[model samples]
Target: MSPPLRNDRQLSELNTPQRNRYFYGKLMDVLHFDLEQEYLIAEQRRGNRLLLGPGVVCGLQVTVIRSGGERGLRVGPGLAIDGWGRRILVPDEFELLPLRLTDEDGVPAPDDDGPLPRQLILSLCYRECRSGFEPALVPDPLCDGPAHSEAGRWVETYALHVHEGTAGDVVRECMPELGELLHKGRIQEALCLLAADCPELPADPCVVLANVAVGPRGALTITDCLPRPVAPTNRMLLQLLICLNERIEECCRHDTVLLKVGAVRLLMGNGPDAVLDSPDERRVIPRGREPLGFEAEFTGAPVDQASVVMDSSVEVLRDRTPVTLPVAWPAPQRLRCAVRNALEPGAYTVTLRGEGPAITSAAQPPDDAEPLDGEAGRQWPSGDGTPGGNFVFSFQVDR
Candidate 1:
């Protein structure tokens, strides 16, 4: 079962003879890439589908044309890639001639509807070629034509695919399987499906070159659309932020208390406590401190109304002893509380804990699947990268 662009190991060897053929005859291998690489590029191109895979390289502009009392289209030269990652090239411009427009005739067809437009679909096409070859033909003395007319190499002209398409149908042709997975919210499964090669992948690759809408009287309307990016883990981030919201009714609510921590860490001593140093968790100054507490950082979405339940959800400990301090939300998306009791500090450990949603993985990943890029996938059991439940972070109060 050879796939598209089959590897033959022989295209690099020689120029094929006219009358005779060998095992090496049809290979199209170049110096940089052998026939094997030719076939293997298919996989490389396939992997890029979700990552800017297919589109026009340059040219291929479709424009409306008018001649006498008739209307048609003029297509410009350009290159593009099909959905299957195959290259489509056009070397010369050509006009696609059509009959007079429905309204142009001054006599509309019996089935003519309103001024709705007609769509034109353009894509890649394949063709065969033949050219003049070796041995010259024997010519009669009276014959005026060339003597070598009998032998010719095969050649063919291939280009645009013209079809009438429905409105907004051009985007629907891309990666239907991946689309289905996304619509179902199976993001990890979609990633795995792309990572692994399976039989469900499409065999015939066809991509849209352009979508042109022709008005009822033959005016061309081309709609240009761009694709946006999708990240697998963006929505799954484990944000531990807590906020408070006040409501006027059941429908409308506004933030009342948004817990925000620090722009800078507050360590002890007076003199306006000037510590001009690079910011980090390690505290340099020794302290019989005035007051102390550390801020917690979180990501993803913030939860509301945490001011009433802050103490139960957050925990702070020095070694094994707990420091009781009232927690409040001064601003949004930051959690903080100050321990008022002054301490004789030599060495201390403060562990901060906050609750977040579950991570991407719950249990052990499938045993058969090998680690990708030498790292476990998101499907693995929750541990480091996957943060869920309550997250723990500790910083030392220095002496």
Candidate 2:
């Protein structure tokens, strides 16, 4: 399938509602989106409501909604995302979405002042955020699972409000302190940074603060609980922010780290270690009456032991008829079995699928290891496990 268009005007011209539809269409086309998975996201059970329009900036990627109360939410022009976090950018106008406050019995939920319901309403006005602009640089949840995007990275979030103030001051104040806390792995300290400097917030209207990182299975859902009038009020806003900070910290922290596989490589029968990197390719199997053997190296968070299952198939390139046989994935260093039957095999393709548990490792790096920098940091596991996914490895076969 052809890739989506990358023109700015083509996308930016649409309002938020339209853009969201476009995003959903692209997600279904490119990422294999499923309604079942959407249900799973809603089932994760946390909600957060972020007002995205003029002056609001969010770096964390997820779905955000507006409180359908009387405050009159607006999507500015286009998403005004910038390098500096404090920019007053405007996104296109989005239509108002309805809020649902009903329980499973279709009855109104009790108003006990606990929190808003996170059950997603199909018609609600919300959009899923991505990492990069234009062609969003986020992993497909369908292909890699939601946990894949955050596999081994630390994630921090904050509540941002658009009001009057220079972006520079806010950036200068928050970035340095937050960066220090992140660098030193001081999670608790980082969550408290915003509250510590509460007195320095830009006068009436502007409010922003940082807090703790989310866990591997962590999910955030934003909702509208506070009244519209309380939004613009300073005293009420501060109280709400304090409450939010405490809640976020409590929800995202955990004892065990989550892990996921980063890469996989396939090598055929004791050859010169030629790697089958592409998803599809052509190869030749010997005409001998023997099975084709192959081994794979699964790289990600190195753990003490892992049990892997492989799904494989060999199909004739011309007619695309799959040749059937008993298949097995070998031990860490052993080859199990290969193709047994050899019909009219001029050229064929073999495809392999890999799946396993979200692998974890408690192994620590050597004390004398070099300081992690740039690519090195990425290569070294952050002592976190990765979520598993079905991976494909394909190559052509010929006699």
Candidate whose lDDT is highest:
1
The per-prediction tally of clashing pairs is 18, 32
- What is the per-residue lDDT of model 1 for residues 25-96, given as tens digits with 9 covering 90 to 100? 565433223344443444444443433445565676767677875566676786655444445567888675
Best by TM-score: 1
Provide the lDDT at 84 for model 1.
45
Backbone clash pairs in model 2 (N, Cα, C under 3 Å; residues 3+ apart or in different chains), count: 32
Residue-wise lDDT of candidate 2 within 1-399, one digit each (tens)?
223323222222212321124443454543334334333332221111122212223322123344533222222232222111122223334422322244322233456333323223211112223343233256656645544442322122221332211222222135787889999999998888755742221122222221212223322232322111111235546878999999988997644432323323333334453434332323444544222444433333333233322222222232465555444545443323344433343443333322223222334543222111111113322212323333233343345
The Cα local distance difference test for each model comes to 0.43, 0.32
Worst 10 residues of 2 by lDDT: 368-377
Q: Give candidate 1 misplaced runs (Cα > 4 Å).
A: 1-57, 67-70, 82-86, 97-124, 133-156, 160-168, 172-189, 195-399
Candidate 2 displacement at residue 202 in angstroms: 38
Task: After superposing candidate 2 on the true structure, give the runs of residues whose Cα lies further than 4 Å from its correct spot.
Answer: 1-270, 277-291, 301-319, 324-390
Question: lDDT of candidate 1 vs native?
Answer: 0.43
